[model samples]
Target: MKWSEISIHTTNEAIEPISNILHEAGASGVVIEDPFELSKERVDRFGEIYQLNPDDYPDEGVIIKAYIPINSFLGETVEEIKDAINNLILFNIDIGKNSVTISEVNEEEWATAWKKYYNPVKISERFTIVPTWEDYTPVSSDELIIELDPGMAFGTGTHPTTVMCVQALERTVKKGDECIDVGTGTGVLSIAAAMLGSSKVTALDLDEVAVHSAILNIKLNKVNDVVSVAQNNLLDGISEQVDIVVANILAEVILRFTDDVAKVVKPGGYFIASGIIGQKKQQVKEAIEQVDFTIQETLVMEDWVAFIARKN
Candidate 1:
C-alpha cells in the first residue's frame, strides 16, 4: 500500500504540458501548489496545524505530485517520466524557465501510512466526530455525534471553512425549520441541522461520492430519517422554500449562485455563506445586495468570513 510521490517543479507557463505527461504515466492523482498562491500567513497557519516547514518557497512556480501504487511496481515508467522531465527542459523551459526537481519516495514504513493522519475531531460542544475505527460514546449531556472517515472527499469538519459553517448552523438552526445544504460535502452541515432540531434537512452536492458518503454519515449518526442527499447544483431540483440555506463553497461560485440561493429561501429565511477570502468580500457583498438579502451577521476566522444574510 506504499505510494511513490513524483514531484515536478515547473513555472505556471509549463504546468499544463507537464501535467499531461504525469497523467499518461498512470499517476493516480496530481496536486499543484503554487508558491504565489501559498501566502506567508497561510504557510504559517499550515505549519502550526501540520507541523510542516513554512520556509519552502518557489518563485512563480508550482509543485505537481503524482502518486504511484507500490504493489504494481512499474519501474519502467521512471524512464518515460524522466523523458517527459527532459522534454520540459528541452522545449518549454523559457516561457516558464522554471527548473524541474524530481524525487522518489519508497519507504517500507509508509505502507498505507496515511492512517496515522486520521483521528477523531470535535466539531461542536455537543458533537464529536468519530473515525470508523475508533470507539466513542457521547455523554448524556451531548446532543449529537457524527461519525466519518477521511476517504476521498472534503468537508471532514476539520477545515476552517467547514468549522465556520457548522458554527453558523449552530446559531441559525431552530426547531422545525426546513434547511438545505448546497455543495454538501460529507453531508455534515445538513446532518448538523437535523441534529439541531430542524424538522427536515436536504443536502446536495455535484460529486456522486459526496452524495453517497453523506448518506453513510447520516445513517451513522442516526439522522437518516430527517436528513437526505441528492446530486444537484445549488438546489436546482428543489421546489419548495426552506427556512435556512447554507452554502460553504468558494466565493466565485457563491456570486454565480446568488440568485439561485435567494430563490430557494422562504421570505425571511436566512442564508449562511462561507468560503469567501478577504479580498473578495466586497464583490460578494455587492452580489448579496443584488438579491435583496440584508447581511444579518458576519463572522471572521483566520482571514475567512461567513456572511449570515436574511432575505428581505
Candidate 2:
C-alpha cells in the first residue's frame, strides 16, 4: 500500500489545533519535529539513551507530519484540512509559516518513520512517558512510567500541556479519590491519575478514535481496572461529583464548558486545565473564575500555559 505524508511547518502555538486537523482528515499517525528538542536538556538517570540526528529537524519552526492513505479522495481531504487550519485564525491562533507539503512513501517506510522521534523522557519529577517500542528502567523506586502508542491520537502524553496536567495530578490526587480526565487523548492523564492512587478515573473524549486509542493505552499501562474510557463531550450529562477534574484541550473549548466543569467537581476538589496558549491564559482564567473556581496556580512552559483551580 502507498501513503501520502503531509507535513505542515508552523509555530509551536499552532501545533495542537493543526494536529487535530490532520487527525480529523484521516491521518493514520502524527509525528512532531521541533527544533527545541535538540537544545532541550535531558536527565538520563537510568542510563538508557537514544541519539537524535540534526538533519531530521527544522531550523526554526516545528514540523508536524501525518500519514494519509492514498485514495481517490486524498486531494479533497488535504484541501479540507488546509481550510480548517486557515479557519483557526478567527480564533486568534497564530498559524505561523503555515506551509504544507506532501510526498509519497510505501507502507513499510511510513510504519517506521515516526518511531525515530519518540524516546523515553521524564517529563516531571515522578512521571516518565516511554514509548511502547522502547525499553526503559526507572532510576528511582518512586518513579512512575506511562507506556503510550498514541496511534492516531493528537498527543504522546509528553507534550507540555500534558506534562503540566500530570504534574498537577501528582500534587492533587489522593488515595482512593475519584477523578475525571476530559479530552483524555491516549489516556495518558487517566493512567497517571490511576498510578497516583486515584480509586477510579473517568476518561472521556469526543472522538471515537481517541476513545479507542486511550482504552488501548490504559490496558497497556495496566490501569484499565482504575480508568474507564468513554466517548462523550466535555462534562455534558455528568451529574456525579468527582474529587479531581483535569482537561487538556484548546482554550476556546475550555471556555465553552467551564460551567459544566464547575458543576461536576466536588467542593474543595481541583480542576487542572491546560493546552492553552500564552495569549489566552487570562481569558481561560476569567472563565474559570466566572464559574466560582478559585485560581490556585498558573504554570507556563515555553508558549503554553496550564492552570490549577480549586472549587471552594
Candidate 3:
C-alpha cells in the first residue's frame, strides 16, 4: 500500500489546529518536524536524546507531516485540508509559510517515519508524557507518567499548549478537588488531574473520535476510576461545579465558552485555557475576564500562550 505524506510548513502556534485538520482529513499518522526540537533543552534525567537529521527539519517554522492512504479521494481530501487551514486566518491564527508539499512512501516506511517522532517527554514538574511503546523509567519519586499512542490521532500530549496546561494543573489542582477537562483530546489533562489527586474528573469532548481516544487513554493510564469520559459540546448541560476547569482548545473556542466556564467554575476556582496563539492572547484574556475571571498567570511557550485565570 502507498501513503501520501502531506507536509505543511507552518508556525509553532498553528501546530495543534493544523494537526487536527490533517487528522480530520483521514490521515493515518502525523509527524511534526520542528527545528526547535533540535536545540530545545532537556533535563537528561533519563539519558533520553533522539538522533535527528538536520535535513529533516525546516530552517524556520515547522513542518507538519501526515500520512493518508493514496485513495481515489486523495485530491479532494487535500483540497479540503488546504481550505480548512486557510480558514484559520478567520480566527487570527498565523498560518506561517502555509506552503504544503506532498510525496509518496510505502507502508513499511510510513510506520518507521512517524515512530521516531515520538518519545518520552517530561512536560512539567510532575507530569511526563511517554509513548505507550517507549521504555522509560521515572527519574523522580513523585513523577507522574502518562502513556499515550499518537496513532490515536489526538496527539502525544507533549505540545507546548499541553505542556503549559499540565504545568498549570500542577500549580492549580488541589488534592481531592473535583475538576472538568474540556476538549479532553487524549484525556491527558484528565488523567493528569486524576493523578494529581483530584477526587473526580469529568472529561468532555464534542468530537466522538476525541471521546473514544480519551476513553482508551484514560483507561490505559488506569485513571478510568476517577475520570468519567463524555461526549458533550464544551460544558453545555454540565452543571457540576468544580475547583478547576482546564481547556486546551483553539482560542476562538475558548472565547466562545468563557461564560459557560465561568458559570461552572466555583468562585475562586481556576480556569486553565490553552492552545492560543500569541496574536489572540489578550483577546481571550479579556473575554474570560469579562465573565468574572481574573487573569492569574500568563504562560508563553514559543508562540503559544496558556492562561491561568481565577474566578472572582
Candidate 3 TM-score to native: 0.75
**By lDDT, is 1 or 3 better?**
3
lDDT of 1 by residue, 62-180 (tens): 77767776555467676677777677767736325344454556655444445455556665556666677777666556546677755567866767677778888888888999999
Off by over 4 Å in 3: 4-51, 55-104, 107-112
Q: What are the per-residue Cα lDDT tens digits for candidate 3 across 1-312?
A: 998989899999999999999988997558888998788875453344566789989999999989899999999999999999999999999999999999999989866666776878777777788888889999999989999975544767877899899999999988999999999988999999999999999999988888998888888999899999999999999887999999999999998989899889999999999999999988998999999989999998889999999999
In model 1, which regions exceed 4 Å deviation?
A: 1-65, 69-76, 83-112, 137-140
lDDT of 3: 0.89
The better-scoring model by TM-score among 2 and 3 is 2
Model 3, position 285, has a per-residue lDDT of 86
Using all chains and alpha carbons, the TM-scores for the candidates as numbered come to: 0.72, 0.76, 0.75
**Candidate 1: residue 65 lDDT (0-100):** 69
Once model 3 is optimally superposed onto the true structure by TM-score, how far is the C-alpha of residue 157 displaced, in angstroms?
Answer: 1.1
Q: Per-residue error at 54 for model 2, in Å?
A: 2.4
Candidate 2: worst-modelled 10 consecutive residues by lDDT: 41-50
- Model 1 Cα displacement at 271 (Å)? 0.7
Of 1 and 2, the candidate ranking higher by TM-score: 2
